[model samples]
Target: MSRHDYFSQFLHAVWHGESGHPLVASLLAQPAFAVYRNTIFKGCVDALSANYPAVRRLVGEQWFQGAALAYARRHMPDDACLIAYGDGFPDFLDSVDAVRELPYLPGVARLDRYWSESHLAADDAPLDTAGLHAVLASGRDVQLAPQAATRWHWEPAYPGYSIWNANRDPGAGPLSGLEWHGEGALLTRPEGQVQWQPIGLGACRFLDACRAGMGVAAAAGLAQAAEPGLDVAVMLGELVQAGAFTSFH
Candidate 1:
């Protein structure tokens, strides 16, 4: 094998402990090597910790660090930039048998990931009143901004949204009861900062339809279908003010 391949395999074995020592097994015995390995693990753990603060807060530092190290060992960093690391963490949480009792962990992690993604999304100008007016005059389909991100997760068994929100805001009071509700989160970069809003169920459908390239009327119809009493005009106005749409084509 090429030297590069050999080096890769050596480091892999070191990180995963899946095989015998690398070519320089004696070197691995050095205290410095141990420190290096630990540093790498710590870095990965730190990144995961930052990305999923809510998860860490929910699970406590010890449990979170353990899980983070295990996950890092199995799923090494694919990108040099750690900002987007742990993209698969929510799914990973679901697979962990230990966390099965806390089934809401995955959903909370998903929301945490959403926040990180939105925060790192490219800067863009949000659709404003004049843009909305132009779209209204054209009478065409609309699409979300490239930086806009929207997701919905609902579990009848758990209150994922409330858990996420409570943990996200430091001063929020502890949750009293586990009430289940469908939650919709929308993220957009407006004025160079990522802003997120918890939207209503009907509004979630509306955004979904709009993102799917539906015109205002059609999207509004979809929203109203989900919520019969929904006010399409008002909902559209609110979404526009929230900078949800980029342009109508």
Candidate 2:
């Protein structure tokens, strides 16, 4: 093998704790290699920990660090930059046995991922009230803002949104008895800060329809069908105020 190939193989073995490579003796003699390995592993651990603060908070520091390190070893970052490194960590959390009792952990991770994604999304101007009115006047289709993210997964099974919101603020005392219901989350970065609000099933469906390029009236119809007593106008007003749409055509 070429010198470069030999060096690469040596480093790979050191990383995975395999000491059988031909250059293992040489690498073992260098103390810096061990330091480099530990630093890389710790960096990955810290990145994943930051991305899933809610999960870390739910499952104490020691538990989180152990899990994070294992996860890093299994799934190294695909990119050089580690800012959005834990994109697949929610699924990883689901596969582990340690958190089997905490069924909401995966969903909390997913929500945290969404918050990071929205914060990194490209900046776009939200549609103003006049623009919204003009589109409604023209009776055309509407599209959701690039930053807007909506989900309808937290139902009777697990209160994902409630759990996340309660723990998002470190100082927000212990969560009281959860008001179990079909709660959804709508997230968007309006003024450089990612903000998420609890929404209803009808609102989520409406937003989904809008995402699919449905006209205002059709989307409203879908929302009303999902919830017979839904007030389309009111929901639209709330979404508009929340900066949910970029523009309507």
| TM-score against truth, every candidate | 0.86, 0.86
User: For residues 123-183, could you state the per-residue lDDT of candidate 1 as single tens digits?
Assistant: 5555667866776667655554333543444444566778888887787789887657666
**Best candidate, lDDT:** 2
Off by over 4 Å in 2: 2-11, 19-21, 24-31, 148-156
The alpha-carbon root-mean-square deviation between model 2 and the true structure, to one decimal in Å, is 2.7
Overall lDDT per candidate, in order of appearance: 0.76, 0.77
Give the TM-score (vs. native) of candidate 1: 0.86
- lDDT measured at residue 205 in model 1 versus the true structure, 0 to 100: 80
Instruction: Kindly give the stretch of ten consecutive residues in candidate 2 with the minimal lDDT sum.
Output: 146-155
lDDT of 2 at 227: 84
Residue runs of model 1 more than 4 Å from their true location after superposition: 18-26, 29-31, 137-146, 149-157
